[model samples]
Target chain A: MTETPVKVLVVDDAATVRLYHTSLLSEAGFAVEEAANGLEAVEAALTTAFDLFVVDVNMPKMNGYTCVETLRSETVGTPAPVLMISTEDRPGDAERAYAAGANLYMVKPVSAERLVRVARMLTAGRGIPA
Target chain B: MGLVRRNTPPPEETAAPPSADTLLSQLDDPDPELRREAALGLDGSAEAVAPLLDRVAGETEAAVRDAMLTTLAAHDTAQVAEGLAVHLASDDAGLRTAVAETLATMPNSVPALLPRLIDDDDHDVRVMTAMVLADLPHPEAMTWLAVMIREDPHPNVVTAAIDALLPSIGPEHHELLRGAVERFPDDPFLRFTVEAAVK
Candidate 1:
């Protein structure tokens, strides 16, 4: 029996970044979905079941922190691991991400290898194709 | 009985509109609605630029901020552009977006300040400015974007410039895109973006 691919929702306001992350993950055999902002990410989370969320910190309508909080809130209550990637590398940025229920926080320009490895580690045993 | 119309020149215009000073004070009112009204009332008052910018820095209410920004945008002066440009560094994403949106509308005023903003030490600010340039209707936007694509050191900021250039890409820009690819040879995303645009 062929198992379903692990699903990931990549949220970013920049279309190029979204396409880049989507392409990387798709090439790695994950079913990747894209959202332009936090509001859209929340909307997608409501109807779709994603195993992971790759969120960007700075976005219009709703930011990554608020989006992650909402996903963990009763409104959505998604238990999927959230990996927040942002250009903001201030002292408390990572702490803030964790406080908002993110499983991990990474800086921008995260290497392609690291991204795939971390994503695979986070979604381990979630039916990702071998 | 037959109706008779009596008009006495609308009560002789009893109350003159509030002065700019009066409206300026009202910006501090406890009621956000009053603050919004005050902002709107300050339109075309050049001296109000400083105070409106001060209010924007701390304004929590979105409606009031929008009102202030709208009032500022009407000025079309370098000071207004400079005042708005400072907020691009704000940590609040909503405020940053709002400021960018407001700045984009001031094509005449914002161009003078673009160089300094694009050269900001913070890469995020550069990225935001690049995005703003994409929406600015000024004729020089393409030149600014091409310079960024060829010279900006950061991949994210350069990527934003590349995205801005995509709408108007031409054969003339192919070499610039190739230069960007060469500048960041290891960045797959940048290379992919250049490939997509050149294709």
Candidate 2:
């Protein structure tokens, strides 16, 4: 039997931003899933098998920070790495993501190359979704 | 501490001939564009990965680093896989796109290494993931794509999956595709693709 590709869930409010990041990460050899809002991202995470997560901080419905926080509260034992993508340049943004249980935080507009590199790093040793 | 020869990059080092390693030596050149050009041009060459890996940490300019990432994309050499992995983590869109193209063509570390990209948060990365997975046709990819077409909000990703389906999709997925096309008439690509597939 053939194995499954790792699944990444991307959460963002903008259609274009979601498309761009998804295309870049997918091109770089990733299997991508998209959520238009933070609530959608959270729902998907709870049900689907995801290797990694790339979320936006300022999405409609549930924001990325809240989504990650919710996931941390509900995942019970294993917590997948959360790579938060945001436009806020403040130094505290990183702190906020960490507080919300995000493993990493990136500022937008992050390049396609940089996003791929980070995905590989976070998912490198982890138990990726099949 | 010692006076290093400025003109030449040393005999033993230049053996690979014409690449980023040699180009990196010129990054310090007075010309800004030359530095940028060299950084971009050295990508993916066997000689460039080592030094580029080091320089990536220190280089601050987005323009120059972007060039370096392009150069890195040219690298399919196994010698640079580790560093290439590092670039894969980068947040730069251009570099990620380059790496995706590069990964699609090259022999990656393992079939196992391909999955991480599929589930990436970036949409381009996901679309590219379909392409790279086509190179190997992992089963998990088909499942992920199938779900995306069903649940994802964007039509582009759905279209990408339809394009990737026949080549990378395994035999067990026929039923899934059939149901999918039946459910979503909006997807013309899948409609045509499924028609072609049955043929």
Candidate 3:
């Protein structure tokens, strides 16, 4: 049987941001989900198993850090691989996200091409784990 | 540490037409930093670990995988979760302890994880495990703490054992610290901590 595409969850407080991230990954053939904020993202992570999740640090309900914290703490769920997106461009922000368990922190204004290249590289050759 | 400046973009990329999954496909670009950055990017996200692991497993680069693993280890992804289980079983004492310590952070994993440190083959693991458990206020764990104080071979273990005991020690455990002081008389850290405990 042919395999299904890998799924990704895009999370941010901003609808525009979610759509943009979803576009980058979806065109690359990844199935995509969206959450308006970190809390909804955590809820989505709890119920569905996505291959990757991109989160923003600043949000009303829960921030990116809190979202990662929740995923790590809740054991029964499939933990989404966390990529932190933030505009907090301070030096320590990336370090803080890493410390809080973000896999990678990307500063804002990244090009769409770079996003596609990065997603393609990460999901390559990783078949669904049984 | 203001190394970079940025703008607030839309939280998600909803504005763009959906793109293909070729985000990191150009990993072969000439820049080694690209490979390194690709490794970083591939970490933690489900879409990221498999390729990074392949890069680590196949590519000759020694350093690339560490960054990837660090990122993978941060999230409790399915791959990372399995890796955590294997790491707990690792024979290397320090690595086992470190893995246990990391796994201990998640409350959902407390049952499977807490016992590893208690019965850990390494003294450091045992001591650290005891320290972690002291907060739970388990009496049985305290008994193991006392036993380790009375028995571990390392001088630092003796002191660490004493330090672990300090959190919840009672009158019955006084003899254990006293005995450790005698066993590790040359260890000033132990001697001081024990002397303080018994007095």
Please list the Cα RMSD from the true structure of every candidate, rounded to 1 decimal place: 3.8, 18.7, 25.5
Local error of candidate 3 at residue A118 (angstroms): 1.6
Sorted by TM-score, highest first, which candidate order results?
1, 2, 3
Error of 3 at B70 (Å): 39
Assess the local accuracy of residue B175 in candidate 3 as a C-alpha lDDT between 0 and 100: 76
Instruction: Give me the candidate number with maximum lDDT.
Output: 1
Q: What does candidate 1's lDDT look like per residue over B34-136, in tens digits?
A: 9999999999998889999998979988789889999999887888899889999887656787788788889988999988988899988998888788889
Top-down lDDT ranking: 1, 2, 3
Candidate 2 structure quality by residue, lDDT tens digits, B40-131 = 76654566677776775456564676576566545645544445544544444334434444455555442445455545566544554554
TM-scores, chain A, per candidate:
0.97, 0.89, 0.89
**TM-score for chain A, prediction 2:** 0.89
What does candidate 3's lDDT look like per residue over B15-64, in tens digits? Answer: 65222244256345456666666666654456665555444334333344
**Fnat scores for every prediction:** 0.30, 0.00, 0.00
- Assign candidate 1 its CAPRI class: acceptable
Off by over 4 Å in 2: A75-78, A126-130, B1-199
Q: Which whole-number lDDT from 0 to 100 does residue A73 have in model 3?
A: 78
Least well predicted 10-residue stretch by lDDT in candidate 2 chain A: A57-66
DockQ values, each candidate? 0.42, 0.02, 0.01
Candidate 2 per-residue lDDT over residues A1-130, each given as its tens digit: 5556667888975555666678777877678999988679877877887888898775434556667888888553237888998654455768888998999988655656677888988888543422
Name the lDDT value of residue B196 in candidate 3: 61
